[model samples]
Target: PSLATLNIPTVWFNNPNVSYSKANLGEELLKFEIPRYTEWVRSTEAGSFHCDDTGLICEVKEAVTLTYYFDSWPKLLEEQNTEELHVAGPLLNFKVDAAEAVASICIPHFLCLEGEDSSHVYIAHFVEGEMRLEKPDRVEPHHAVLENPKFSSLGVVFKKWFKQKINTVVLLYHRLHLETPTFHLYLLPNDPSIIKVTRNLHLWYSRLPGSFA
Candidate 1:
C-alpha cells in the first residue's frame, strides 16, 4: 500500500528524502505462545477507564515492579586489545520519580591509553515520556539542510532518514513486574483511549526477571 492511500502525513510520502520498499516487509507473522504470566501497566489516574469484559478488575494491591531485558546485543563488539578488560553495564534501570519518569543507560567509552574508564551514564528524563536533553543541542552537520528539532535523541535523529520506510519510536524503560518489564512509549495525538489501549496491550516477557532480577 502507498503512503498516500494509507492517509499517512504528506511529509512522509512526498519528501525527496523519503522512500519505501516491501523487500524488508515480511509475508509471515511471527507467532508467540501464551505467556505463563501476563503483567500489564495502566494508569486510571491518566484517565484509563476500567471495563468488566474479563469479569475481573485488577487493582494495585501494593506497588509492583517489573523489569524488561532486551536480548543480547545483535552482535558482539570487537575484542579490545588492552591489557585489562573494562566492564560496563548495558542494563537499563527505569523508575518514576514522583510524577516524572527517568532512565539511565551505561555507555562504555575508552579513555586514552589508560584502559577502560568508568562507563558514562547517558540520562534521559521525561515529564511524560517525551525525552529531555540538556541545552545547546544541535543537529548533525550532515543533516543541516533538513528541518529538525533542537534537542532530539539519537532515535529522533535517525527518523528523518528512515521514517518513511518504518515506524521508529523511542520507548524508555519504565519498570518490571511479575517477571516482565514495562516501557513508556511517547504517543502523538496523545489520545486517552489509544494511550490506554497501548498500555493495556503492551507485552511483557514472562520468563524475564522482575526489577533488579
Candidate 2:
C-alpha cells in the first residue's frame, strides 16, 4: 500500500494560525506563521511542534514563516537509482528564511522490517541533481535525526537484501456475474508508483461487465 492509501493524518502545530494545503501529486504543505523568533525557539525547545502522527520534528535557527512540503515515496525520484533501493520515509522539502534547521522523522516500523539492521538505513539528500546518502545523526527505535545545513529533498532509503521479508498487505476483490464469479488477488509492495498503477488498473477493471455489485 502507498502512503496515500494509508491516509496518514496530517501534522498539527501548536500555533493555531498554521495553515495546510495539499498538492495534486499528494504533497502535504504546512505553513507556520511566527510572530516572534524568540518565542518560536522557546516553543521548539519545549517540543511543542513535534508531530506524533508523522513523527516530524523541525527546529529552525531564526523566526520565519516556514513552508514545508512532504511527499511520500515520490515518483520524481524513481530514476535516481538503477539498483533496487527501498524508501523508508517521505521526501521532506522546506523553505525558510533562516540559515539552518534540523529536521527529523520517524521511519515507519513496517518499513524497518523485523530483524533488519538499523545501521543499514541512510538518509538520501537530493541536491543539485545529485543524491547523497548520509548516516543519520541519531537513530532511535522509530526515528532518524538529521542535521540539515541546507534542505531540499531528503528521505530515508536502504538497500534491500536477498530474502529480506517485508511486511506487506494483500488485497482481494470478487466480481459477480450471471455466468460465474471471479476473484482477483493482488500482492503489492508499499510503493507509491506500484500502488498508483494498481489503483488505475482496478478502476478500469471495475468498468467492465460483471463488475462488483
Superposing all C-alpha atoms, what RMSD in Å does each candidate have to the true structure?
20.3, 11.2
* TM-score of each model, in listed order: 0.18, 0.50
Worst 10 residues of 1 by lDDT: 8-17
Task: Tell me the tens digit of each residue's lDDT in model 2 across 1-213.
Answer: 132222232321122123222212125342333221111222333222554433456554434344554443434465577275666554555455553443433333235344447677777877766788888876654456776546665666766665444434465667776567776665554433233334444455567787642
Q: Provide the clash count, candidate 2.
A: 0
In candidate 2, which residue ranges exceed 4 Å CA deviation? Answer: 1-103, 107-110, 113-115, 138-150, 160-162, 176-179, 191-197, 200-209
**Candidate 1 residue runs with Cα over 4 Å from true position:** 1-25, 33-105, 108-124, 134-213
lDDT against the true structure, per candidate, is 0.22, 0.48
Q: 29 in model 1: Cα distance from truth in Å?
A: 1.2
Estimate the overall C-alpha local distance difference test score of candidate 1.
0.22
